[model samples]
Target: MKFIKTVSLAIVGTALAIGGAAAQGKTVKIATEGAYAPWNFTGAGGKLEGFEIDLANDLCARMKIKCEMVAQDWDGIIPALNAKKYDAIMAGMSITDERKKVIDFSVSYANSPNGFLVAKSSPLAKMPGTGEAFSLNSQKEAAEKAIDAVKPVLKGKTIGVQGSTIHAAFADKYFKGTADVREYKTTEQHDLDLAAGRIDAVLADSTAIIGTLEKPEFKDYVMVGPSITGGMLGNGVGVGVRKGDVELKKGFDEAIRAAVADGTITKLSKKWFKIDIAPRS
Candidate 1:
């Protein structure tokens, strides 16, 4: 879901663990933005629970390394990783060329499309190509055409997107001048604003939009418009680690491949997202 952010050195806060301290031997402190539900989020009593949380545990077991999961703010997640605040990140981070310059990513573990969320009663609920899908990378013309189809309906609407996300960049590129594209610090923040009627629509990962729709408070909201993937949206979601951490990256890659091969990813994704998001490539 992420776009890009300049790395910062400022220390934010102490990382909070979701699991008990790991046993000795090369503990990998994994950072997660414990707010994006279905992907990762803080559960009851501050316990972390979600797809990535489960996947992290499985991957760690496969790697035979001690794993520590910690909560980190989304905006500074990459910077924190570079700053040594965490050994890796598994917070539904997309593997984009832009991000690869600052950090390395393991082979993609999951892939999902991006879309819009709007009130069921809103006119945008009739957004064109509502259930259709397009890839900006392989279907550039079609994807651009699909985007053009939604522009008129979104022209004067207010759209909310999580800051430092591909959705933010997409909104800026296509909807900023015509629509009021607002940025929030996290998906939950935007979801709140959307629920409060502060925003006309929200552009985010379809899985995240689905997460919002699962909430009773968000029952009136519906995912609309074409599902978008690839291009600036990123290759797919992967494990983000410091650029120099080749061994760690290699380990994660192997583990993820195994997980995908063995249907671990499929099982976890279905458990959380109700669909298989395992990367096909």
Candidate 2:
């Protein structure tokens, strides 16, 4: 009788462990700002589609969880995640220190630099260091020089950026005094303003700029200036979760690593951004 009871207790414990695992894998609610094109966007039928969308599905599959992706406004994405409206965020969110103070991020799956979009005829089109790349953390002097080189043309010009983003922070820090920085609610809004000549240029992710440039209306537009990364740009794009969700974080981290190793991210990035934005590390 003693041995039978001991065996029954062991089986109960095993069942409980299995039940916990199943509950954890049941479903993961993910949020994405369906406005950031090529990263994520609303399609013709109000369906969410983009690089991050595909990557989110892949990551969820790797973790053996069903993913339900919901479109959330960009400005409220982080707060919504904290409110438990969603279990995770795969909205091309960069892992900046300021953001990390609130929510934890999984291993970065992609990294892309930021730049300016200007009309071909604009004086800023000739902004110096056109094809150069700079890491403010690794090469501060050169990056600062590159930044200074473009300031003259940018002086007195108005630049548009999506509000509450790193690009906005960058413009505020580096170009505020020299140039008028206008914050828009979305990249599409700023692109419209740029097309209407309301703003001289738009500062944004290179991938996003490239997406805009592909449109027929933007035929005359071009991405100018150096590609800026590191420093204020943060540590690349990752899946964001609440700070206390360690198991969920671990699952995403492992999934991302697996996806990176298998070239899945590279394939999806090329399909969307036409460039490899895979995290270097």
Candidate 3:
């Protein structure tokens, strides 16, 4: 994801006006998976501190609403939201068509590509398009070419991905027949398995993998293969709201627009991920 370079003052002003008008002084309960580092995770004292946590606070302030953030397991986040356990979800959830069928999404707040984490000593480390980013929609040929190039190396390899995630979907779509796909409840579980040499590789968001690589235990692992985006990965990350909550979605969308217009998202992203992943205007 590229850094947000320029923001239109006019857009900021418009967003603020909309946000002010939409403000209802209502309390909004937001849920996040506390395990996804640099996005939303538990800190030293079990307090949530990360990009999405900060962004959620900023957006809530902009919306003039009281916000309560709760850490929910990734696998059950959506179900809990539908169960009315939370008004919204600020987790690092991609806005895919399948998810949209059950919940509405605010405008995207951040954009990060997905990739693989493999041991540096593995042959898969030399997979084609090592540092290149591919969008299945705009760069279909290039993405397919990279996938073809890596297929041979991936054949018969056991890969792990967090269940109910885009990474899992991608593995099922691309490697089901060629590779052994294992699903875990959390990325941390798969990361542990990767370190134990239980899985040949793990596929996940590049941002998440960066966090994993920073840990001393994962020193042997490195992000490899082509950076993936588009298609099933969906359009960046957005706040998930119930389908009936149109007004809530509108309020969040306006706040997100304001945050993007003023560069708050980009600023927070850098502070957390050390990279600019603000959604492109």
Clashing pairs in 1: none
* Residue pairs with clashing backbones, model 3: none
Clashes by residue pair, model 2: none
Ranking by TM-score: 2, 1, 3
lDDT of 3 by residue, 1-281 (tens): 21112111111112222222234433467888888887988776667777888888888778666677888888888999899887889889999999999999999999999888999999888877888889987998888788787888999999999999999999999888999999998888999999999999999999999989989988887899898898889999999988877778888898899999999988998888888999996
The residue-by-residue lDDT of candidate 1 on 56-108, one tens digit each, is 88888777666678888888889998998878999999999999999999999
Cα displacement (angstroms), candidate 2, residue 117, comes to 0.4
Looking at model 1, residue 9 earns an lDDT score of 22
Name the candidate that leads on TM-score.
2
What are the lDDT scores of the predictions, listed in order? 0.86, 0.85, 0.83
Query: Candidate 2 residues 127-189, lDDT tens each?
Result: 999999999889989998899989999999999999999999999999989999999999999
RMSD value for candidate 2: 9.8
Please give the lDDT score at residue 24 for candidate 2.
Answer: 49
